[model samples]
Target: MSLNRRQFTKLMVGGMASSLLPSSVLAQGTTKNNIKAIAFDGFPIFDPRPIFGLSNTLFPQQGKQLAQLWFSKIFGYTWLRTAGNHYKNFYAVIEDALIFSAESLKINLSPNDKRMLMEAWLNLKVWPDVKAALLQFKKNNIRLAFLSNFTEEMLRRNAKNSGIDDMFEFYLSTDKVQAYKPSPLAYQMGVDAFGLPKENIAFTAFAGWDAIGAKWFGYPTVWVNRLGKPIEKMGIAPDSTGKNLNQLVDFVLT
Candidate 1:
């Protein structure tokens, strides 16, 4: 293919720029980075798929729909409570969402079923890619913490279940500020706990909206798009995005 003079100059400049970065940095983008600490949203670290699997096991007919609605309602309540100043803890919000989902689907959820479903959240394991990435982060001296909307009790219980509780240096639950994410106060927990600038503290978000929230608060954010979802049309984007923790490790440690 032939190139116009302007196109040729652009290609030449791009080539020169690409040469200056490490291979991983080239993929993450051209921006120079200073990410010293990473603040992770809980779902990215703990595999929540098992909870959905249990829903399927309990209600074979309505399980898929129930799980989707319940998942959506969980975040819906968080945003609603934040806006209305109702301020329910995440665990309560989750239980409320589950009940609403079951009732809406006309599924008669037994007390034992409900108990088992909620308990699943407390016994989650990390995703397959999580341990290697976490070990690398620890090796690199990159400080780590949880910046989740989950209550500290929830986060701690899940971490303990995964056998990785000691991996986190802090748990910056939004419970402390009584605010869910997208609020500046909620994101500020990372900066305060890490005692680092928002730019230096990278936030790993499990959902697109949460990634936008962290970016809006000035954190260089990475959206771990584990479900292969598209980015939200929020007029903002994460600095990097990946399907799992391994890609996140490259973006940060590169």
Candidate 2:
């Protein structure tokens, strides 16, 4: 469906799926062909479901709760660190988050379970829609980079494990700046790496909050909402929103 900005905003906040919009409900001064390069949040490129899935398998009853808590703590720690200018690598943050989550839920996490959970990060694969969209982006001469909170080591290992490491032109992980997403310094990596005006680069976000962050940083943004979650109520919206990389590819390449 073709949704105007207000309509998209209303539906999104109402917790509705408005994916596959042929046209974007864009911010002022944003326009077509504004997308030249794409700086993607890591989750848009890497499928993280398996790690959570393993949680479900490992702790059958407490599985879902454990996964949810762990996921939230990971970002909570990142934001806390970013705010205090206390930067730590994402690998450590993920481990610390998992430990906190397990403790909060009173789940006794074995060393083996912890190891398996942490190792899952190193084995992430791309979403099914990613490779095709990437190939299309390359064909059109659109530069591609990862602008994510993930540590460079995590990003590289996952990409290399997926066998698509060569697809990226740059890896702009938060470690380079010691700041996390939603921080202007972190978002600047895209403009610096691509050597393009901020308006000329498209930022693809996997989470609603990241969409708000990229938009605030002055990039035309796309939210790749694979799970069809509601946009965060931050009074900010992405320039375009879609369900998968193919829809994002259409937004950029069309």
Candidate 3:
């Protein structure tokens, strides 16, 4: 049940159109204020390209390969550890993945290179539309929090660096449950943090798989498809999909 990129996109575009149909035809008269809280995946707000760029600088010839493998391995390690009932914080998973990626690619990763790459996560810049959207949420008195796999330290550093540290009330990490996303326990962190019914909160997802996860957790999910990636073929679709945070605000605040 695997789909090529093109096929997946065609399905996604079809699903997107259906998902975006007028509210009267969908969730009839769903009010904007019905949503009281928003749980955001960290990458939707903070851009991660600079970290890949740093990897490229360190490994000129194998940079793209290294970056791709490193990113994949990071999640792979997380999932494997979770399934095995073994737990490690996101930071440790990332470091292990990077080391494995370097070894697999036969590149000599210097201490400086490793340190610089790991440190880049702390210095991420927010996506261009992030601050404005956050302000709109604030104006509307919407509760906002980050529900992500990132450690609190990682989220704090990046939020402070991007000047959005004060925008979020809760900085939730799966570390509390010792599980990664798509795991019900991980999504429960948001539910527990907000103390609101799942239907009253919107989960903003940076990836399609996450959208499915949140939907499964019973939140109205909105996928911020910033990369224009194909939607996953899971049986469930997000309640909505958008290209940026501005669209996200519209989806949540309608």
Candidate 4:
């Protein structure tokens, strides 16, 4: 849906606050066809669902029934459930949703359960194919960076656990900008980080709505639809759709 003028402005402003790029530095370097960076969102950067639910023997509902709602939000449903369940703050909403899902399932979660959940986040094992794909990108000498809403501390810990910290030029977070994806400001922050024009840098996300956000910002976007889900009804379309990061890289290089 096309946002009204007010909504657009709010999204843009929120994006800038949530991203990490310093606005003052955006004008320093060439903003032309310089393919200096390839950016990605962390969740889509790796699949965290298995790790997220690994230890849970059951699924339960709790203080908030938003986890199932969140699952539906991320993956979507065959039919529309409601119109008003839209989330404004994506990160907080996901956390609430996870906790709610755990409670609803009566999984008998404990501090250890929470610890494993948090630790699993830190140690998120990328899909079996991610390493080879990333290696290929490196072989081609393409710069890689992660632009995500994860807190800096959380990202750092996760990077180490995943064993891919050195693969990135740098890992950035929304904390620096204070906004989330599907916001032009966040995309611009990534662009500004490379000091390149929107078209020169490419971005990828597992979520179709995020792909829409990047497209709206004039960046070439790849949608990693591992499950082959349908496109989001957000109007914009991704430049390429692939089943995995490896497929996505091949598409970009081609």
What TM-scores do the predictions have? 0.87, 0.86, 0.87, 0.70
Q: Pick out the ten consecutive residues of candidate 1 with the lowest summed lDDT.
A: 23-32
Residue-level lDDT tens digits of model 1 in 115-171: 999998878888888878888888767789999998899899988886889999998
In angstroms, give how far residue 111 of model 1 lies from its true place.
0.7
Show where candidate 4 strays beyond 4 Å.
1-35, 58-67, 70-94, 101-110
Per-residue alpha-carbon lDDT of model 2 for 1-254, expressed as tens digits?
78999998897875544343323333112435667788989999999999989999999999999999999999999999999999999999999999999999999999999999999998999998888889877776678899999888888999998788998999889999999999999999999999999988999999999999999999989999998999899888898899988778777876
* Candidate 3 similarity to native, TM-score: 0.87
Q: Show where candidate 3 strays beyond 4 Å.
A: 1-33
Clashes of 1: 0
Give the total clashing residue pairs for model 3. 0
| Pick by TM-score: 3 or 4, better one | 3
Worst 10 residues of 3 by lDDT: 24-33
RMSD of each: 7.7, 11.6, 12.8, 14.3
Model 2: residues with Cα > 4 Å off, grouped in runs: 1-31
Tell me which residue pairs clash in candidate 3.
none
In candidate 2, which residue pairs clash? none
Model 3: lDDT to the true structure:
0.89
